[model samples]
Target: MFDLVIRNGLLIEADGVTKADLAIDGEQIAAVGLSLQGRREIDATDCYVLPGAIDPHVHLQMPLAGMVSTDDFRTGTIAAACGGVTTIIDFVEPKPGQSMLEALALRQEEAKNKVAIDYGLHMTIPTWHANAADGLKEVPAVVEAGCLSFKMYQAYEGMMLDDVALLRALTAVGEAGGRTVLHSETGPVLDYLRAEALAEGHVEPIWHAYTRPAPLEASAVHRAAELADLASCPLYIFHVGCQESVEAILQARSRRIDIWGETCPQYLLLNAEEHLGGPNGALYVCAPPLRSVEDNRAMWHALAQDALQVVSTDHCPWTFEEKQQPDFTRIPGGVPSIEARLSLVHHFGVNQGLLTLERWVEVCSTNAARWMGLTRKGRLAPGYDADIVIFDPARIKKITPATLHEAAGWTPYDGMEVCGWPRTVLLRGKVIVEDEQYVGAPGDGRFIPRRPSALS
Candidate 1:
């Protein structure tokens, strides 16, 4: 007999959904067929059994602007588990003059015994110089250590890379069989606009969105795509927020460039004008701030059309008091959504007819795995890790900070009604969440070593 079995559930995969029984032996799915039995069984009648979602981006306890985000590895992954995420990919930002491998080791130390679910790391190229032989030479070793991906920024002051350096770094990573993930925003333009706004006495939260308008993001995406093409590198764009950026991805893919795009729930559901103007507006402050209603519509359409391959939560969070700043620039920029992504997407994307069930699974789980090289973590087939989520379609609730596991004191989606919450979650055949309450322990999670990107 198998170790455990989930019976009479509708199994949802990226390709299709069907009624089946899933059996697990040890930590892997043993079979998916009719009449499967196990020594221990869970009744899943009327539930949707899906592969646990994989959040490809998050920043737990990330330091920014002299303050660290509220959720650390332990709290953050617990929240993720409650929301049905079985794996997450977080970044490693090396200190100034630090080697990439050194930063990776330090980051692993921080999360070693704290994570509540499996996780992988992506090395961030803080700054790249053509003459910097030592830094570039570590790409292959880092990849060999199982990172398999690198992050490059085009917009931060100290972290941004110039075109030449970016191209060179992309080429180095490509030659090492790894993919390059980019944060596409034009730094100089943003600085100029923010200075103009602040000089004009426009210090409200709305100015944050006004200063970093959609065109800057689109232009940066276009530039990054061109550089990736020149380097023959596989590229993944993070937090794509507008239609112009979506069009840029479409154009690049039309030419057979190996490129992928991701959008977050904020860009898909919240609009700038409505969510960024009140006294509490600072709470929604985040980089590449929310976009217009038309942009939200465009984001949904792009996901449905497969122009965007992943929908991840850039799950960085700050406390409410920490966000209360006199100037918009002083406000820490990030919002918490690690525990809300799946339900929000299921309510707004699937229940509202914007995304099919299969498409939802693809964007929320399968595609992220395929692109990020988490080969065994994102599927429920035999021999794959038995990470699963059982969602109750009829469950409904209004969101409130009190009901969430994020250490942040508030949420951007407060009071929004949503359906289809995860009632059970399994990580490697171990039940970690039952009835939406996390039963997992700290240090139960292990580091996931990734393979080269499947897209590569």
Candidate 2:
């Protein structure tokens, strides 16, 4: 007999939707057929059963431009579970004097008892340091150790890689069986813009995005794509927002470059116009600051064209207290998103006809898993991990911090109405969230490694 059975639920994925009785044995899926018997049966009469979300780009806990994000692995992963995500791939920072392996080990130890679902780490190569060089050398072992990918910054003063090192790291990951991910932006140009903006007395909260214009992001996107092409490396651009950036990605993709781009719920749901509105204006501030509605429309079109491959939260949450502490030049650059990415996408995209249900599965779950190399993290089938969300298709819910599971205590998505919500979440066949509450322990989360692909 199967251990658990999810009955009468519609299985939605990249392929299509079908009615099935999905059975689970221990942690893996046991079967998907009619009349499956199990120790427990959940009647998912009108629910949608999709693979749990795999959030590939997130900063669960880490230093940012100045302050740290509000969510730790424990709180962030629980919020993720409440949102129906089962797997997360977050970054691990390098210690000033530690080897990449040393830093990675330390990070794993820290996360060992701090997560509520499966997790993995992406090594962020801070800059062109000797340790970065040494770290790149062990990437093969890192990949073998289940870390599997490297990340680079192009904006933070001390963290962004120089042009030569960026190209070199891309090439090294290409050769070392790992993927190279980029946070694209022109640091120097942005710095110049911010100085000019602030020197001329343009320091209002709304001026943040204005200081770093879309052209800067677009130029960096082109340059990064060129570098990735030069190295013959696989590229993944994190948190893509502007039209020009997406266009650059599309143009490169047309030439058959193995490059993937990601856009977040913020870009899809909020635009530059909101940043300039009201007394609560400071709430919308984030790096790659939200762009115009036209940019948002263009990004939506990009998704419809399959030019944008993934949708993620870029799930970094920060307090207004800490984020607002920076002067115009140093204000932290992120938004609160751990609990809102999926529902916002569903409310706006799926309901408005911008995304078909299949595409929703692709953008929110499947593609993220495929890109991050989490093999068993983003599907529903026999032998796949029983990480699933039982979604109520017609349930109407408002997004507010009052209902969040993240330690951040608040959400920027307050007051937004959604027609569907995840009412149940399972991680490796264990119920983590049921009826909108977390039921799992923190240490239950495990580390995930990418399966061999271009990273091989």
Query: What does each candidate score in C-alpha RMSD?
Result: 1.1, 1.8
Backbone clash pairs for candidate 2 read: 117-445, 177-455
Which lDDT values do the candidates have, in the order given?
0.92, 0.82
lDDT (tens digit, per residue) of candidate 2 on 1-456: 889999999999888898888999999998988989989988899999999988888887786655567888888888888998888888878867657788888888878988998988898777744235364676677778888778888887778876787888888887876887888999988888888988888777777777878888888888888888888888999888998898888888888788999898888778766764545556677778888899888777777778898888887777766655445455566677767677777878888999899888889988888878877767788888899999987989988788777666567678888999898999999999888888999998998777666221
Error of 1 at 316 (Å): 0.7
Worst 10 residues of 1 by lDDT: 126-135
User: Clash pairs of candidate 1?
Assistant: none
How far residue 336's Cα lies from its native spot in candidate 1, in Å, is 0.3
Best by lDDT: 1
Model 1, 268-315: lDDT tens digits are 988778988876889888888998999999999999999999999999
User: How many residue pairs of model 1 clash at the backbone?
Assistant: 0
Which candidate wins on TM-score? 1
